[model samples]
Target: MRQNNHMLFRINLARRKFLRQGFSLLASAGIIGCGDSATTSATTPVVIPPDTDSNDTPGTLTTTSTPQQVVIIGAGISGLIAGYELQRAGHSVTILEARERVGGRVHTLVSPFTNGQFAEAGASRIPSTHNLTLAYAQHFSLALDPFYPSTNNYFYLQDNSVSLIDAEQHINQPPWPGAVNRSNFYKIRGGMANLPLALSNALAEHINYSSPVELIQQTNDQVTVITGQDQQFIADRVLCTVPLPVLTKISFSPPLSEEKHLASNGGYDYTNSTRLYSQFSQRFWHADNLNGWGDSNWPEEIWQPTWDNGESSGIIQSYLRDVAATELDTMDVEQQIANVHSRWQHVFPELDSYLLTNHIHSWQQEVWTGSAYASPTNLQDSALSAYIGLVEGRIHFAGEHASNFHGWIQGAIASGIRAANEIHNAN
Candidate 1:
């Protein structure tokens, strides 16, 4: 009977893996098809002319004789990529970033942890189906590793914990329905920030860090971008790549259309999310022969960030969203850390003595970001998605929120390429 149960677990795992991969393939193709707002425009179709140079790569744009001056807001992936592609096409580009650092939500932290262990505070994993993201990673020559290579996972519910491998016997049933089993998730080696760092390094001279955009004024022939520091930049075109929540802070000349304004204000759903990373002096979870990935009703989910890093010390991360995030937000940093530690201990008593240090990153409290990423409230609202990416006069919009692959790095890259292509074709 025991042998039969083990065989059943293996069979179920294989079946789940197959189904997950099939669904992922379909979803990727669907997102790619629906992600291009320029082609799916409701009003006038955006016509992207074929490359005049046959040798030009798909992502690279052809150089133009008359270069147009372009100003990009927010030095995130979308803005940086837009600036890089535009400059490569022989256009003068200037990028204005509100924060001292770039990479928007793709932040990686190394300090406060020992033994070369690191953790991602935001935007941790990349799905294999994200071709554009993969292309950029390949371009940068960044190494990739499985996000959760181990098949073993833990579930803590209602004050009880069980390994997924023994879940059937413990719970007298199979694992929870709709549980993801595929190993398609990946993270960049060194850190996820390496992605934006590569793009930033390529456009070092063009990026103006700590320059926050205040307002934008566009005319028939030119557009003017004003910074909070009272500096003004004039360009032939401007791309607004700031997050929707942050975008609301910037004023536009003549104001945006009512629909667009509303969309930027709150039409999209930006989840209140928080991430906590805790490093331990010893690999307590691994010593128990259990993968340090877990989920619970209390804190949404938790995973081991240093699982594939071959580090003796371990880093476990917890993600809290919605109400859990709100509840934690009310507490002080120390209180929040204690709360997470206590809750993690409740799930795994072994973690109590091994924890050495902890760090917290609250996206809800992040000034420029406000929230993690935007999600469509109404799934059928294709126009809502398409409208955000539409070119508004000489001003353009590009971000993860504007793409169908919302919340992923791929969305940002695709949006940036689309915006750059729009400017290049116009030239």
Candidate 2:
């Protein structure tokens, strides 16, 4: 059950560094947005019958045994990759998804906006260091583009004071607040969600959407998965890829390890990451040579999601976590908009004048994904992290929560592959 940043903020009081991180901390610090709107065009999911008659190559592994029947829970990047690779390697894979769409936390949202402009509702940036994510993009032939703005200056609001950080200085700094060297970051050209779509397509007719797993039970030789609707799937191996929060909903027979129970049963701390995206009639800040992105003492990362798009209209997003995010969650949609408008104006004074429409994408709100990425709430959580991804008999686990890269899609991809290999090589 989920949808999903790790950009660190430049917390230094120095003027140039104030917005230097520019919503940097949210993603870098492991805070990320989750639960994209289901209406995104790129995320339209198709349900297909599970693979019954499996495929196989005339290889040693195939000749020795029958193809493994794999049940992969959650069609996120990790789950999809596991399913795709398993099916490709001649295993029968069935992916159970809670939502009608794929790409749990990595989605591209395009709606209620004009002029072919779009915004990222979930994971956006893919750093060069994320070889797995990059390699997949290349595998799918998806184009890449710089994630940061390349024009004018970055904005920051401190003590109700608006200031512009030099664009050159901003770009010269590293990716996060206090990183070693300047690194490059990129996003999929069309949208971030396309990566998952490609994976989903590759596993066509094997993905079951709107089929949430309610229970997972296993015997010595096989595992049985029961969906919320009473549908059942039996597999030689079951890979659970849901976030810790969502994972709590699925009952497990014989119970999971104490560590897994600790991590999923509210023992883990997840960020309440929220993004407020507002579209304007024109690129108003460009007149002042500002990219309409920065940070505020209000403890938020302001981003113009479509800053690079050569469109007449533009959109800006505000990334918030914890206290700031929880505060907005209490209000109605309109109130949330008003609350953001009142505060965001201090950074971009001419905001309300050019505003056309706005929407809030809060990760905690989606039923499938209850919170953002997992971070150790305390020492117990830190200790519990290692056990989160441990394999159970006839069952395995994978997700951003199970990986060191917690908040990024790369984490999910890596963990999925790890679990897939574990099952693939198992006797």
C-alpha lDDT of residue 384 in model 1: 72
lDDT value, residue 284 of candidate 2: 76
How many clashes in candidate 1?
0
The CA lDDT at 145 in model 1 is 53
**Model 2 off-target regions past 4 Å?**
1-66, 178-183
Best by TM-score: 2
User: For every model in order, what is the number of clashing pairs?
Assistant: 0, 15
Error of 1 at 29 (Å): 8.3
Tell how far residue 58 is off in model 2, in angstroms.
Answer: 23
lDDT of all predictions, in order shown?
0.72, 0.73
Among residues 3 or more apart in sequence or in different chains, the pairs in candidate 1 whose N, CA or C atoms overlap within 3 Å are none
Per-model TM-score versus the true fold: 0.82, 0.83
